[model samples]
Target: MSIPHGAASAAARPDRVDPAVRRIGATLVVGALGVVFDTTVVSVALDDLAKAFDAPLATVQWVSTGYLLAVFVTIPLAVWAQARFGGRRLWIAALGGFLLGSVLSALAWNATSLIVFRVVQGLAGGIMMPLMATLLMQAARGSHPGRVMAIITVPTALGPILGPVLGGLVLHLADWRWMFFVNIPFCVVGGWLALRNLPDDRPEPGGPRGRLDVVGLLLLCPGVAALVYGLSRVEGGAGTTGAAVLVPLLGGLALVGGFTARSLTRPGGALIDLRLFRHRAVASSAALLFLGGIALYGPMMLLPLYFQQVRGEDALGAGLALIPQGVGALLARALAGRYMDRVGPRRVAVTAFALVAVATVPFAFVTAGTGGAVLMAALFVRGIALGAAMIAPMGAAYVGLRHQEIPDAGVITRVAQQIGGSVGIALLAVVLQHAAAGAHGPSALAGAFDRAFWWSAVLTALAVPLCLLLPGRPEPPPPARTTRTGEAVDPRRPTV
Candidate 1:
């Protein structure tokens, strides 16, 4: 039954709790840290990976590109996997898979071998990321969703804050292999906590359970991966190559289109629940997510390079210089979370995007002699905006979805953000590279970077309109009849 206004639901009944809700929160936080760290650590090590393996930068980038592709490919399968297997079983397996891949990556003999190992890691890592949210939210049982989201988000929020710093320290002190090794402790601890604290609830048996959607997956995975790969290729390699990047991109579009059409006509076994898009909040928030990713991740890819290329700093120095931005982001998350709960996500997102545009404008005019203090101030402000930009869109997307539909919703939002990041990074890289090619010395390079940053500001500005679509404030939860389980409810109908 629907929990009454400001009242706890069955999932949060004090008498029903196995131990306490906060302990369950602890486990989810720890598990999420491991998954988030692994995703960003490899990003810092790409240059090292290329040098050690004696491969070109383009070839070595596959180490990351492959992993991202694998994540996109496997994300749609999480709900089904949770249904076919138990949540606890799947989470443990996902953690184990990542651990295995990390060990293998450490010992890889060449670039080709490394790419293969990274893909395995990506597949496992992919599952762990969303499962962190799925299990924790499920356990909380629609009581204190705000608090539950905050706990699970701490690590996710920290990744951008801590990843580059940690990756830089490891690269400076040790070899690239240590980056992969770092994941071991997290995996071990997370798996142990999950086994101990997680619930034993099996899937709702009468839901969409049966044959897997092989055709749906075949269409969706390769379609997304190809589009992303093509984008990366343009960034690495550009001209007809840049224009021609659209070939696989178009093919990927066609494939996704076909799969979407196929899934709609099928029974409950559709690969993704396309019907969720009917929610105005979900659809618009997803659009904001796609654009915000382009804006945030685009600069994320550029800021370090600007430090290294224009300011002549080493990898560690560039990372150290970027810490202000991270610190700004970490500090703003709590404030943003509280504001989102009280004022609604729409205003928070719109205001954040505007601040992001303002903060980024300073970079468009950056110079060789630009004061470090001034640059750091700009980054800090940008990070605050970054925190708000990231959190509000996520909060808004799930504003209307029911507890059961949440897992599927999580999958959709994560995929959009990830794929959007891939696109943003690739496009920004191409922009910067093309801009730099027109210049020679540091001064010329600075000018080119300015041109690219200008574009980023425009993209950030574009995200403002999309925020209007988010629900204004929290509505009362759905009524009792809709939420109760174990009745003859049709699987095909909407839960809300």
Candidate 2:
């Protein structure tokens, strides 16, 4: 049995990534950092914002809640917007909107105003997140997906690491308003680079621009927002059966179910083509991403709280303690990207998920007196596995997708991960609360976190087998040919 030429070449040199792809990824990351960073940074500032406005914490919580709801509302619109407008135009427009929102938020006079302004930021950010991946993957033309995804995910990786630390620093030295003001540099630089680097891809004049499915939009936007809102309410210590949680959750599920039915019946004209679920890569990746979200975000809530409530660290100290996990995630990126491309997503995803579960086990046994070095070591390993776990599925979702299909896939995957995160946080929050009910000492609190961490570990482990459903080792690339000037050109590369 002879090895295929493409396979041999791929084996020989798996790290070949295009310079243009790198440029595009760099440009997108600059803008995306603001969105990702803002979400995490603001998370730490909600308390401060409440104090600044002399408002009740519940009222001020809307500043973050409103932003999240707005994001859900606009997420489904990205595919249509990018189709109606070019990617370049949409990128700049969204950046401009975020910049405006940031400015307004910084100047907000009250909680209500800040909430409204954050909604503006969310609307713009919702578009950029999916568009960033769609643009990069389309540019890569199905080649080097893992590497491209690594570049695409730079902001996500950095957000967890830097957002809180930056937030803590800002609050220590400045006012809460500076949190929004800090977004100015990212927006300005991102907008400028986007103009220069991104290709103008507006739909051709008189081309068949599909009509926006207003019905589908109406069903999905509010459905997703309601779902997220309900879950967030749960995170705020409300029970699942509470009116605030159940009303929105059931309503959201009903609306989303309606959208799903409508989309399945009218795939061609729907806001998001539900038919993409037919693809094995898309379907499996979506399922795994849901689990990955729980594994990632559920513990995220517990880690900081464990540090604060059980270990007696302040906000800044808690944030600083998480630095090791971030460092591990960073270190895993390059290696994970390379191997995901070379060996494929399935093996990597399974191995990574298993490792994540294993790493999480130490936390399940956490005690008030657990050594800091030991816990940090566990977090570092968990971070590495989590990073690879995310990169694998994200890159896999795009496998075998066409240029036009990329945006829809992007939207589906993003929504899945996000909703999954909401679910994770809510469920974990409930668990922690129930386990710690009436607890007074740090020792008792540590035991409650242990139970919650156990749930996180079990949830993560469930995905290990599901990862087998992901696409196996990538097929060999098509052969490269030399141009007239002897420049090697990949025949598979997209000219668009």
Candidate 3:
């Protein structure tokens, strides 16, 4: 990440995101929209799906849980798969898999079939999530982490806000199948763009292709799935001591522990390379991402439920109520990226996270009679803070890494955030379940939501100090190298 002192500062290009970066960023975001929105959209339809399939609520929930477990199983394979097949090829392939799965899921005849197809989609999605970040970050090459991340995070910020709305509409009008149908355009357009735009960074002729880390994959993949399964049980409204919670949680922990030890014992380049944590920025970012996941996603569960159950809004109405938060996040990217480049992630993240804490307080004090306008205003501000909070730590993770190291960093950060979100949602679910148990009114439900918001605010506050560990400033670009000819040589690889 070293740069020549005389090179132009990154601030010079603050408003001028690289054209290639824009192209790559747009393509990745388009494809990821399906995955991101699919997650949130399908969530609103769980009850519909249960009734449609004539299944128990618990049985139908597996559609989401199975997909999540499938995702965890495939994430550890991204680094090896990309190195062997090249990022462009893998991107299109994964997108195609997701497309196929989407179509199959739409045609599913039963809950069991739907669950299986969703798992297929999840396997493809798991690869896409981490690979998307790796390809973009590696292409940007640490030159403009702030702007790069701002572009990378559009899907994340939008997914929570828009997914539910879209899902609500689908459930309201059409059947559950339309939820899967919506993804078709994003996948088709995304894959077509990748075929045209992405770089073909395959190994040089006769160059060695890396072997899969079979042992590491065996240990870590199942380990992640186990942990996710355990967490999903919590969302199923199981008590902390229930078998649903303990079996998977304990089993997942033991497997994860084994993976950690095995990853440590292996030399360099284990499946995920646990050694990345030794770097202060990388380690600290992972921790913050974990807590940040909880902060951003935990309340997502409570907010909609609160509106629907207490405020008497339908699913669509609840989704509409959350629009301000997404709008705020969408609006903050330019400023967040600019200030991050100017003042560093530490200052930006700490301020952004503090804003998250402040915004969350309004919810903690909500009453059955709270004004809708007041709550919406608070949500808008919360979205703005969350958007900035997410991007700052994300960009900081890659601040000092070499282009080759981006994939591993991508996997680490992606896993941390995913697991953290699961834990956050699960914790809040447990609290809400216990708080509302035997209660039977809007006021009682509002009380449960208030407690959950308090926990979310506390979790966010916990992440503020960790922001101090992020890298101070974006480093200058590496000194350019030229060929024997007078013309500047091509960069090692083109980004988009």
Per-candidate Cα lDDT values, in order, are 0.77, 0.88, 0.86
Cα-lDDT of candidate 1: 0.77
Worst 10 residues of 3 by lDDT: 1-10
After best superposition, candidate 1 residue 151: deviation in angstroms? 2.8
Model 3: per-residue lDDT, tens digit, 1-496?
2121222322345346667667888999999999989877888898999999999989989898888898889888899999888888899999999999999999999999999999999999999998998888776656668888999899988998889999988888998899999999999999999877777777666877788888788878888898888888888877778998889888888888888998878887678888878888899899989998999888999999999999999999999999999999999998898888878899999999999999999999988999999999999999999999999989888876767778999999999999999999999998888888887889888888888889889988999888888888655554555556643322433433
Candidate 2 Cα errors over 4 Å, as ranges:
1-15, 480-496
Candidate 2, residues 311-392, lDDT tens digits: the string is 9998888888888888888888888999999999999999999999999999989889999999999989988998898899
Clashing pairs in 2: none
Q: Can you tell me which runs of candidate 3 are displaced by over 4 Å?
A: 1-15, 489-496
Better of 2 and 3 by lDDT: 2
Clashes of 3: 0
**lDDT for 369 (candidate 3):** 95
Maximum-lDDT candidate: 2
